[model samples]
Target: MTITIQQQFSINLNALLDEAGVPASGFGRSKHVATSMDVGVATAGKWLSGKQIPEYDRLERMKEWLGCSFDDLLGRTEARGGRIPARAENVLLNMVGTRSATRISICPDEPASIRSDGVYALPIEGDVMSPYVVDGDMVCFMPAMSAHTDGVYVIHVAERYIVRRVNLTTRGTVKLIAENARYEAEEVDLAEEVKRRNGVRIVGVVCARILVNR
Candidate 1:
């Protein structure tokens, strides 16, 4: 049977929240989301039931209260643009703006492990990292000069940037995995590809993500 946009949105929303690690009972008629977003319980319930889509302003606020992205909350598996901007330091940015790398500032509230020059802030255009990295969600990425124990990274290849999780296989090869299905995983043999011949390379490691308030 064909699904209406409302139905589809509902399905995607539930799945996305699940992926984001939201407990099913965390949001309900208890006025949790409604109170958090300053909306009515009926309005929040309607959203969960897919009876209505929250307005743009409410949607943005909901992301903050729930800690997700637009494409993520809506459950979109599309490809997002490459490269995002981050402060020169490891901190949480309250207002993340989309500007050239030269025009960003650094804050020192949230601390983490990252690099100096390796840290970059670029423009994110779409939902390639949807549910994980959404629109206006500029994140902090450190240059992945070497393999990390484990975590999502911004695989740098041919000057193009792709955000994904990477793994080092025992066969001396590296596996690249993306959060969205649109981008498939790539296995790069170190001894064969990088050592023997030049091939795709890792550019950056996504050590941190900064959620911007619209």
Candidate 2:
């Protein structure tokens, strides 16, 4: 039996959600989809029910959130002989705290160490994370709702997104540390920030670094 495009999209989306460890059904599923796709819960419900598909802009957001290719999401891999097109996995590089919308393709030849589903990439643009992760390089991270002190993470604070080494202080504050010593670390009181409408959000945890060739 031939599957309709909506059916195909639903199937593909479910598969990706499964890989991400989301439940197959219920409010949890719809909520995760909504959060990941950055859409309303109703919209996510429609997509999950196969009543509608995402528009191009949302598709781009979905690609980054799910860390999959358009082919994978649109069910085009079968027509392409089961091989994902070269650099099919493209992610918009969120430079500094702004959305640049500049996409960088992940070459198929990338080492397995940095390849994984549900992983997103952010391009480093300055010396803030220097030496450990220099400018012109891209860091691959897994989308995370929370931050841990074990590693570096991309976070939203003071109305800007940045990559920093997170350290949870005993004084109920989160410290954002830059790898470059010249830059002083900043500590934020999460509760106060939220009260002031300046909230701290954990975007993702850095997993691997893709060194760009100069």
Return the TM-score for each candidate structure: 0.44, 0.43
Candidate 1 TM-score versus the reference: 0.44
Query: How close to the true structure is residue 89 of candidate 2, measured as C-alpha lDDT?
Result: 33
Q: Mind giving the per-residue lDDT tens digits that candidate 1 earns over 1-214?
A: 3434554455445443433433232113225556767888777666654567778898788778656677655643332332222222323222122323433333222122334443555444465654345566655554556574555665545434556666778877778775445677788764454453234655555544543422
Clashes of 2: 0
* Model 2: per-residue Cα lDDT over 70-145, one tens digit each: 9787864366465422221332221222333334333222222333344566778787865445576666565566
Residue 68 lDDT (model 1): 66
lDDT of 2: 0.61
Cα error, candidate 2, residue 100 (Å): 28
Candidate 1: stretches off by over 4 Å:
1-118, 191-198, 212-214
- Each candidate's number of clashing pairs is 11, 0
